[model samples]
Structures are given as structure tokens and as C-alpha cells.
Target: MQRGLRSFIIIWIGQFASLFGSALTRFAITVWIYQKTGSATALTTGGFFAMAPTFLLLPIGGALADRLDRKKVMIAADLTGGLCTVFMLSLYLNGNLQIWHIYLTNVILSAVEAFQYPAFTAATAMIVPKEHFARVSGMRDLAGNASRIFAPLLAGALLAILDLSQFMIIDLITLSIALLTLTMVAIPKPTQTEESKRAQANLLQDVTYGFKFIWKRPSLVILQSILLTLNFLYTMGNMLIPAMILSRTNNNELILGSVQAVMSAGALAGGLLISIWGGSKRKIKTVLMAQVLTAIVGRVWFGLGYDTLSWLLPSFFVFFFIPISNGSTAAIWLAKTPPDVQGRVFATRRFAAQFCLPLSALLAGPLAERVFEPAMMPGGALASLFGNVLHTGVGAGISLMMLLSGIIGAAVSLLVYVIPLVWRVDEILPDHIAEPSSLIPEKTVDSDVGVKAPEGAASPAD
Candidate 1:
């Protein structure tokens, strides 16, 4: 294997294992909580605590990724996060685990995650050539989707056969392997430039600098605006889908599971296809096309599904387009952003895109339960208008939300394409041409392999 790709593969393998174990633990904990409390509120609160800290701390994390050794950041995160899991295991083994205990552990893990993600994302750019950016993103997506597809089933089987604490133990073991792998690999450091040096003088200035970086670029601003709208609508739809499925299936867990599996399968397939194809040469086009396709297939067809097959078949297309869209968008950022600043920039972008998630989550339930549900009921307002197509039923309100959200999402996607700034974002943004000096050092190269070439000079893969 080429040296750069070799390093990436080693890191990817470790992360893949870590993701699988984390998924197992997550599934087990979610099930354990719901089974114990039988309250969605408790479950939701757990999720909120898990994500809130990470969301609030992302900017600081990005700053650290830019300033600190990426590998050390990852190692420290893993060690601390592993300790949280170990603590959970102890509580569970002693039969003293409380909901608050789980919440506290998740808070600690989230804090670790704020650092871990930026470090890992920045580290990836250090190891992977620019030409392979989309492919690498696809590979990462594949790992995540694989866990999503299989983890629940694995967790279910294990829960039936073994103790829940065992899952935490398994998680700790995977984390150890991940930490060990981090130790073996070497990540390239960014070449210190005058601007980077200036940015590092004050931590507060550095944290805010990420926001300014994106704000200063008109094309990026347009792209981010599009993403913000898209993610908000997307989250709203996601928040309602499960309830819609349950109502449609009469709370049939089997159908729900099958539908989820199909969606995961689609994402897995999409990631695999992107890895091979590397997407469009003009990556912005790839992103736009995927967005439009998903708005149509995912929002429209998904909303219009009247039966099990109708509901799930479109899901395959919905998820299939997501990775393509996300990978292409990531590729654009990877191509445009400086490696030294990628951590902060990427984190800022992520924060902006996801900032609306909690709000959407908070509103989705109320929107469905009170507004859409009541409005879709017999003799209620708009019942006559939508009831014929969507039907006045348990899931009908969710279906209505789906249809509306999809329509808005599609319209916004079309509007994005019409905007000249967003349409030509790739052309307008400057690509960062990396120097070999920022990557692997000559002394570190194997005598057999000789010196490593810089990413910019490396020939595209055959």
C-alpha cells in the first residue's frame, strides 16, 4: 500500500473497532433505560445529556485539535472515555447503577468526544491524500453504517444471552485496542505558518477564529446556509420517522426493525459505491445532485408511502443518497481548507449544521402529538384536505409532517442551486495545495520505501 493510505487504513481499523463497540454499548444502555423506566422522557434526557456537552464544547475542541498533537489528543480522549465505560461497568456489576449515573457518564464521554472527533478528522487529512478524500469519507461512513445496521441485532442477541455489564467490558476491550493502534501509527504535523503562529497566541481568539474563517468566505457562507436549512429539515423528518413507522405498523417492532435495516443497507451500499466511484470531479455538483435526489426520493416518496413496501423501499434510496451528499460536501471542505485549520473549520461547520438538532428534537414530538395529530384527525382542521391521501389514522399526522418537511426541504434545495454563490462554491474557493513537509518526515520513512511524497505530488490511484 502507499504510505499515506497505509497510515489511514491503520487508523480506520482502530476507529472501526471502537465504533462497533460503542454502538453495542449505546444500544444496550438505551434498551436498559427504556426497559427500566418505561418512560420516553428519561430516554430523551439521557440522549440530551449525551449530546449537549459535545455540542457546547465543539469550538474549544477544534482549537485544541489545531494546537495540540492530534495523536495525543486522540489517545487521551480514548483513555478518559474508556475510564467512563469502566466506571459504568463497576456500577452495573455492583447493581448500583442509576439513571443519574448513566447521565453523568454520558456527560463525561461527550466531553471527551468533543476533542476526539476534531482530532480524528484533522488527523485523517494529515494521512490521506486530497484526491482520496471522498473515498476515505465513504470508508468512514461505511464503518458507521455497518455498526448502525448490525449493532442492535448483536446487542439484542447478547442481551438475551449475557449480562449487560459484559457489553461495557467488551467496549473497554475495544477501546484498549484502539488506544494501542494510536500508539503504533504516526500522524503528520501541520507545517507551522506565520498565520498559524499568530492564531495560537491567544486561545480565545483561536476559538472564535474558526467562525470568522467561514464567515469571511462568501461561497462557504452560502454553502453553510444551505446546509443549515437542510440539516434542520432533515432532523425534523428524522425525529418523526420512527413514530410514523410505529403508527403505520401498529407498533409492530418487526416491521420497524426491518425498515431500519433497509435504511442501513442503503447507506452501506451508498458508502461502498462512493468509495469506488470517488464521486464527481466537480464535487459541488455531486453534493447538489445528491441533495436534490434525496429531497425527491427521501422526502417525497418516504412521505407518500402508504404501505410497508412503499415506506421501506424508498428508505433504501433515502439513505443511499445521504452518504453521497455528505461525502461530497466533506470533500469540498477537505479540498478548500488548510490542514492546520481543518479541525477548527470542520468543527465550526459541524456545529452550525447541527445546532438546530436539539430544537428540532424538542419540537418534533409536540408538533406531531398536538398540532399535526389533531389537525389530521377526523373533523379536525385540514383533515378533509390531507386525510384522503395520507388517511386519518395513527401515523397520519407524522405522514403529514413528512410531506410538509419534504416539500420545504426540496424547495430549499432548489433554491440553493439557483443561488450563484452556492452553485459555484467549488470554483470560488481556493484549494489548499499541501507541501510534503507537512506530512511524513524523511527520517521516518522505511529504507525499502524511500521518502514519502507530499499529497499534492502523489499520483492519483490507478
Candidate 2:
């Protein structure tokens, strides 16, 4: 097996273990918040608390990834996050648990995550060969999806039987395993001297430079816009998904868990398929059309008011595309980024992509509960138009939102295509831009090995 492939498996297993524990905890926390406060706003606040700090710190984290050793950065994040859990677990065990404790924990964890996502992603380029990029991406998704499938049911059962404090111990064990995996593997670190030199400017200037890097690169910018809009739609659907189920069904835990499993099953299948089938020749389509469309299809299903497992059969197929889309994009970034700069570039990318997630948490709950649900529930405004195609109700109204979101996303994709500059984004990158060494061959020795030399720089022999 390829070294990258071997390393990928080791890392994936660790992340998979960590994810299972995380999923269970997420479900438990959400339920805990709701049960304690009985307010949607409070729950939204909790979600915001978890993500906002991370988003704000992404630029700083990007700089760190660019300047520091990524392996150390990752280990530090794991350790910091794990320690927070230890404290939370201790508090919960002592019957001193408060919602404030969870909020504070989220903030610290988010700060740590700012480092973890980019480091792990950028490292993949060093370990995996270009040929296996998509497969590696697929396998990564498989680990996460597998966790989603098992975490809920396991968590729900455990939470029902065990105390939340005990659950923390389980989480502690899983995170410890993830950290162990980090210890087991040796990640290759390319020299970052040039990257460090370029980043000598002030923090604001550094962040501005990152934006400029993308602003000048049409492909990356366009892709970011698509992702932004896609995230909004995704968040909207995600916000409503639970509310949709909760409104119609009595069983909260089972509905949430089983539905999650259903979608995760789709992602698992998609990841497996991508692992085998790879993706379309136009890798962008895998991000935009193939896998994204699959995710959108499930949104349409939810909007359509189909709850029974038989009725939700199509969701399985739609769910399959998410990991494929994510994996395909991962391949694109890994393949295109120069190793030295990847730490910064990918960190910014993570920062930008995630910036909107917290916004979604803020907007989704209110929109679903107040605006969309009310407008479309029990003879509301859009009900008649929706009724023309399907039954008129809150569920139907939300379905309209899903269908419209997909259409809007499609239009956005077409508009992006027309921007011609977007298609040539790779061309607009800096002269020094180098592809990851694992993905390409570059003769000159530089800190960021992947960067293409200035137009005239001759090969080493020259």
C-alpha cells in the first residue's frame, strides 16, 4: 500500500472513533439544552457558542498552520480539546453541570478546531499520492459517516441508561484514541521558510493577503461563493430537518437518530462508491452536480412531507452524494495546493467555508419555527402554491424551500460557469505557487515545494 494510503487509514480510524463519541455528545447536548431551557433560541445560542469562536480564529489558525509544524498543531488541538472534556466531565460528575459549562467548553474547543481541520487536510497531500487523492478523501468521509450511523443510536441508548458525566468519560476515551492515532503516525513536514517570510506582515495584513489570494483566483473565489450559498441552503435544511420530524412525530430521539442514520447510510454508500467509482472527469461537477445534487435531493424529500422509511427511500441516494462532493473537493484542494502554502491556503479555505456555519445555526431555528413553518403551516400563504404540487402544510412549505434552494444553487453554478475567469483560477495564482510535491514534480528547491517558479525560472540544470 502507498504510504499516504497507509497513513490515511490510521488517521481515519482514529477520527472515526473520535467522531462516534462526538456525535453522541452533540445529540446529548442538544437534548440537554432543550430539556433544561425549553427554548429554540437557547439551543441556537449553544450552536453559535460552539462555532463562532472557531470561525473568528480561523485566520490566526491559518497563519499558525503556515508557520508552525502541523503535526504539533494537531496534537495540541487534540490535547487542549480533550482536557476541556475532562473538566466538563468532572463538573458533570460533581453535579455542578451548567449550560454555561458547555458553552465555555464549545468556545475553547472551537478555538482548537481552528488548527485541527487545516493541519489534517494539508497533511494528506504529503502522505497520499495524487492518484489516490479522491479515494483518500472518500475514505475520510467513510469514517465520519460510519460514526454518524452508529453514534446517535449508541448515544441515545447510553444517555438513556448512563449519566451525562459518564458519557463524558466515553468521549474522553474516544478522543484519547484519536490522539493515540496521531502519536502512531509520523507526518512528513515540508520546509516552510518561504511561507514564514511572506507572512511577516501584521495579522490584519496577513488575513487580507489570504483574501487577496482567493480574490485574484477566480476558481477559488467562485467555489467559495458556491459553498457559501450551498452552506446557507444546507444549514436551512439542517435547521428544519429536526423541527420537521419533531413537529410530525412524537418520538424525538428515535426520529433524530434513525433519520441521521438514514442520511449517514447514504453518505456511507456514496463514500464507498466514490472509493470505488471515484468521481466524474470534471471534478468540479462532483462538488457541484454529483454529490451536491445528492444532498439537495434529500432536502427535497424532507420538504415533500415524506416521513415513512419507504417514502424516504430516495433520501438514501441523495445522502450518498455529500461525502462524494466533500471528498472530491478535498482532492481538488490537496492536488492543487503547494505543500508549504497549503497550511495557510487550506486554513483560510476552512475558515471561509465554516464562517457561515454559525450563521446558519443562528438563522435556521428561527426561520423554520417562526417564518417558514408558520407561513406554510395549516393554510398559510405559500400553502396554495405548494398545494398545487403536493399537500399544503408546514412540511410542504419547507419542501418548497428545499426545492427552491436547489434551483437557486443550480443557477449559481451556471452563473459561476459563465464567469470564464473562474475556470482559469489556477492560472491567476502567484508565480511562486507550487503544487503539492506528492501531486506534482517541481525542480527548484523552495520552502513551499509545490509552487510554480516565475515564468522564466529554468530547471535546476539550467
Candidate 3:
């Protein structure tokens, strides 16, 4: 392997390991909290605390990533965040653990992630060749899928065998491994630009610069809006999937697990495929195609599943398309944004992309209870139209909602694809062309900065 690619691999391995550990701890803590409180409101509150800090601190985190040594920033985030796990362990050991403690830990970890995400994302631009961006993104998604599959199973077993405190220790060990790998490899800094320099004078301006950058690009603005809308719809549909499954299967947990596993398998397959193939020359078109495929296969089939096979089959295809769309979109952003400014730009992207998710979460349950469920009940308004096909039952309303969400998602994808601004985003937005080393300018170097490889470490084109 090329030197830069080798380093990227090492970093990826460390992160993959650390993510599994973190996921296990997260699952354990969530289970612990729910068991202790037995209140959905408490659970929701914990989730809110966990996610809210990301929005609040993302811009500031992005600024730090741009201004500081990215590797050191990651190390610091890991160290501090791991300390929170240690604290939780101490609390659990002493029998003083409370729901509030878990909530606090979630918030603290979320704050740390605000710093970690931007730094890691920016660092990726430095290590991987532009041609490999989408592939690397697919690999990252694969790690996420692996973590989702691994963490819960491991956590469940560990919880039965040991305790939550022990799980926290595993997370700490993983963080240490990540820190070690970071120390062993150098992460290139983005070369300084005149604009980057001016923004450094005032952090607030740097933050605003991210917003301004996206706002000035109409194509990017349209793309961001599309993602935001999709996220909102996805969240709404997700909120009701469990209910649908339970109602259809007569509350069979085994069937629920099997269906979810099938979904993950589909995503795993997609990630593997994308990693090998990268994507089409027109990344935006690839993304749009994936989105349309997901809407039709995931939503429509998910809504129409009247039996186990039907649900399992369609959901596999649904998840199968997710990584293709997501990875391609990530590659487009990575290519368009200058590495130096990626931390800020990506933070802005994440912030805008996720802003509507909370609203969807808050409204989904109430809408199901007051409107959709009632409307789809036997002899209700929507029953005459959709009930016969979907059946009149507890989950009939959610099924209709899923069908509508799919139709809307497909319609939106088609609409966006036809819109010249979104359809031609890649062409309209110029790619950031600079040597990776130059992006990591000397001005940002410090004692902890990673050592660069020899000049010949990269291929000629790189």
C-alpha cells in the first residue's frame, strides 16, 4: 500500500475498534437508564441531552479543528471523553449511579464528539487520495454497521456475565488504543489560505464563514435542503417501524430482531459494494439514484409487508441502498470543500442536516396516536381507502404512514433530480484542488503534530 493509504488504514482500524467499544458502552448505559427509570420521557430526555450538544458546539469544534493540530484534538477528545466513562464506572461501582449521571455523561460525550467528528473528517481529506474518498466513506459506513451489530450483542452478553462498569472499561481500553494509533501516525494539516488566515483572527467569523460558504452556493443549499427533508421523513418513518412490526407479528420479539438483522445485512452488503466500486463518475446522480431506490424498496415494501418474508425481503433492499447514497454524498462534499475549511463546512453541513430530526422525533409519536392510528382504525376515515390492503389493526395507521413517506420520498428525489441546481451540483461546485501536504500548512504545526511521510510516499498523481 502507499504510505498515506497505509496510515489511513491504521487510523481506520483504531477508530473501528474504538467505535465498537463506544457503542457497547452506549448500549449498556441506555439499557441501564431505562431499567432504572422505566420512563419513556426519561429515555427521551437522555437522548435529547446526548444530541443537543452536537448542534450547540459543532461550529466551535470545527473552528478548533481548523486552528489546532487535528491529531492532538482527537487525542484530547478521546482522553476527556473516556474520563466521563471512568466517572460513570465509579458511580456504578459505588451504587450511587442515577439516571441524571447517565444523562450528564451523554451530554459530555456528545460535546467531545463535536470536536472529534470535525477533526477526524478533516483528517480523512489529508490521508486519502481524492479518488478514494467515496471508498473510504463506504468503509466508514461499514464500520458503523459492524458496530451496530457487534455492540448490542456483546453488551447483552457482557451485561449478563459482568456489569455495566466492566463495559465502561472496555470503552476506555478502546480509546487508549485509538490514542496510541494516533500518536504513531501523522495527520497532515490543511495549507493556510488568505481567507482561512483572516477568519482565524475571530473565531465567530470563522463559524459564520461556514454558513456563508454554503449559502453562497445555491447547489449546495439545495442539496442540504434535500438531505434535511429526507432526514425528517426518515426519522418519522423510523419512529413507527417498531410499532408496525409488533402489531404485525403479534409482539414477536424474535421476528423483530430477525427483521432488523436482515436490514443491517442489506446495509452491510451495500457498504461492501460501494467500497469496492466507489461510485459512478457523476456522484450526484449516483446519490439520487440510490435515494430513489431506497424510497421505493425501503418505504413502499416496508409499508406493504403483511408477512414475515415480505418485511424481511424489502427491508434488506431498503438498507442496501443507504450507504451508496450516503457515501457518494460525503465524497461530493469532501471534494468540493477545501480541506482547511472542511471542519467548519462539514460542521455546518451536519448542523443543517440534523436540525429537523428532533422535531420529527417529538411529533412522530403524537401524530401516530392522535391522527394516523385513529384514521386507519376500523371504520375510521382512512380505513375505507387503505385498511383493506393494510388491514385494520394497531399498526395499520403506521403502515399507511410508511407508504406515504415512501411516496413522498420518491417524489422529492425525482423533483430534486429534475432541478438543475441539484442535478448539476457537482459541475456547478468547483472541486478543491491542492496537494494534501499543502492543506496542512506549516503554520498550524506543533510538537504533537504527526510526522509527514517521505516525499516519495505518495503516487505521482497525488
Candidate 4:
């Protein structure tokens, strides 16, 4: 590998360590919440708590990222997240833990992450060459997918075999190591321009400027909106999956963990495939195909029930497309946007995509429990509508929803595709707008900073 690429790899490894640790604790916390409360709502609290804060703070975070040194922003975010974990771990270890505690800490960490994301994404654009963007995104997602496979399984086993508090301490240690490793790396930051150095503008207005930028870009807006819709469905399915599995297998941990691992493993493989193949030359084709695959698997997986060997077939097919889709979508963003404006643009992108998660979680459980599930059950009310083809059962019901979702998704995809205006990811959006990195310059204190990779170390494209 070239020197820049090698540095990017090293930096990415440090991030992987951080991701693994975070995943470990996250799994522990999620399980602890669910097992303690036995409420689906309780179980998904982390999802809301961890994400809502970031959604709320997107505008500020996006603007800050544009003004600051990306490396400094990321390193600080990591250190802050680690410290938050340390404190939370201690509180739990001392025998004082509550649902509110988890919620509050999640919000804090997530707010920090709000800053971390845009900076890291924008930094990648600056550091990595265009050709390697796809592979780098795949590699980044591969690390996350690898963690998803192992972290839950490990957490499930660890929680079973060891004290939650003790295992949590291990996570704390990992965070410290991640922060320390980051301190050793160097990532170049862009020099400040005159406009970047001028008197500070209103934070809200700067953010509004970003809004205008995206509003003017039809392709970016449509893609973001479509992703929002798709993720809405995806999260809905996810909410119901645990309940369905629990019904079938008497809520077996091994089954749950194994299934999760299998799906993530499939996604990991997809990431690798995309890393190698990059994606379709006509990016719109890749997106539509991914959507079609989603609709197919979403419709089929639920129908398969818990068929030990066969159940994974559709799940694998669907999941294998996710990384390719996600990475390809990211590549479109990276390629289309310039290095300067990406921070704000992508921050909005992330924000819009996740903004509805809380609402989805809030509504999906009840809908499935009282509405969809009952309708799908044998001889139930809605069975009359779907009774002939779908049949009545948890699997059948979920299948109906999936099929419907897929059909809707396909419709949505094609609508945007043929419109021509929204088909191009790059046509409307402006490239990254250059800005000074002095707003949050690198700190003088070396110990406080994470690894600072030399400037211009190129990362592999996905």
C-alpha cells in the first residue's frame, strides 16, 4: 500500500477498536434493558436515546464540522465518548443503575457522535483519492459489520458467563486503548481560507446555508428522502423480528445471537464484494437493483419462519446487498460533493435519515402488536384481505408487511429513477465547499489528542 493508504489503514484500525468497544457495551446495555424490563419499548430505548440527540443537534454539528479541524473533532469526540462510558461503567459497577441513567448517557454520547460523524466523513473526502473511496467505505463498514457479528454474540455469552459490570469494565479498557492509539496517528487538515477566517457567522444561519445547498440539489434530497423511507421500513422489520423469533423458539439467546451474527456476516461479505467490484457505472442502476433485492428478501424472509438452514437464504440475499447499497450510496455522496461542504451536507444527510427513527420505534411496536399482528393471525380480521395468499400466522403477517413495503419501496425507487431530475446523485448538489479548520484547531495538549495521521494519507476506496 502507498504511505497515505497505510496511514489511513492504521487510523481506521484504531477506529475499529473504538467501534468494537462501543458495540460491546451497547450490546450489553441493550440486553440488560430488555431482560430487566421485558418490554419491547424498553429494549429499543437505546436506539432512541443514542440517536435522538444527534438528530436534534445536526445543524450545529454540521456547521461546527465545517469550521473545525476534522481530526481534532474526531479525536475529541472519541475521548469524550470514552469518558462518558467510564463514568457510566463506574455508576453501574457501584450498584446504582437505572433506565434513566442509560438514557441520559446515551444522549450525551450520541451528541458527541453528532460532531464525530461529519468530521470523519468530510476528512475521508480530503484524505482519500476518488478511486479508493468505494473500497475505503467498504472497509470502514466491514469493521462495523464484523463488530456487529461478534459484539452481540460476545455480549450475550459474556453476560451469561460473567457479571455485566465486569464485562463492562473490559469495554472501558478498550475505549482507553482506542483513544491512546488515535493520539499516535496524524491526519492532515486543510489550511484556512479568508472566508473561513472572517468574523463568525450565526451558527443557525451557517446550518441554514447547508440546508439551502441541499435544497438546491434535487438528487441529494431525493436520495436522502428515499433512504429515509427505506430505513423506516427496515427498522420496522427489525422491531418485529425479535418478537417473531421469540414466539417461534421460546426466546432463545443462542438463536437470536446466531441469527443476528448470520445476517451481519452476510452484510460483511457484501461489503467485501462491493469493495472489490466498486459498483455499477450507472449508479442509479445499482441503487434500483439494491431496492429490488430488499423488496424480494423482505417479502420472503418472514415467510420462511425458523427453518434452521433455509431461513438464512433470503436473509443472506437481502443483507448481502445492504453494504453494496450503502457503500455505493456513500460513494455517490463522496464523489458528488466537494471536500469543503461535505461536512454540512452529509451531516444533514445523516440527520434526515435518522430523524424518524424515534417515531418509527414508537409506532411500529404498537402497530405490529395490536394492528398488523392481529390482522395477520389465522382467522383474524385482516386475514380476509391477505388470507388467500399470505395465510394467517406471525410469519405470514410479517411477510405481508415486507411484501407491501417492498412494493412501495420499488415504486418509490422507480419514481425517482425515471424522473431524470433525481436519478443523478451529483447533478444538483454542489461540491464540498472549502473552509478553514481553525474554528476547532488541534489542541496544544498532545496527551488529550488521539493519533494524528500525517496530512493527506489516502484511505482505500470501498
What C-alpha lDDT do the candidate models reach, one value each?
0.71, 0.64, 0.72, 0.64
Candidate 2, lDDT over the whole model: 0.64
Give the alpha carbon lDDT tens digit for every residue of 1-462 in model 2.
654466567777788787777777777877677667655556666777777887788777776766677777777777787799889888887889899888899889878777776666666677667767778777777777777777766776776787777667777788878777765555456655465566567766765566666665667776776677666666566555554554455446666677767767777887788788777655666666653464446555545554656335654654567767676676677666666666667767766665787887787677666776667765787677666664655455556666676666556656655676554443444334333334434333222111100000000000
lDDT of 3 by residue, 1-462 (tens): 665566667766677677778767766765565456533345456656766787788888887878887777777777778789889899889999888888788789778878877777777777768888888777767766656555655565667686888888888888777667766666556678665665565888887778888899999888888878877777666655655665567655456556655676777788788889999998999889988888898888888876688787887775778888877888899998887888888888778776666566666666776788889888999999997788886778878877888899888888886799999988988888646532444555332332111011000000
RMSD after Cα superposition, model 4:
5.3
Query: Worst lDDT window (10 residues) for model 4?
Result: 453-462
lDDT ranking of the models: 3, 1, 4, 2
For TM-score, the strongest prediction is 1
The CA lDDT at 194 in model 2 is: 64
Error of 1 at 186 (Å): 1.3
Q: Candidate 1, residue 266: CA error in Å?
A: 1.3
Better of 3 and 4 by lDDT: 3
Off by over 4 Å in 4: 191-200, 298-310, 377-379, 383-403, 426-462
Q: What's model 4's lDDT at 230? A: 72
Candidate 1 vs candidate 2, lDDT winner: 1
How many residue pairs clash in each candidate at the backbone level?
0, 7, 8, 32
Show where candidate 1 strays beyond 4 Å.
Answer: 33-44, 94-100, 156-159, 243-254, 377-383, 436-462
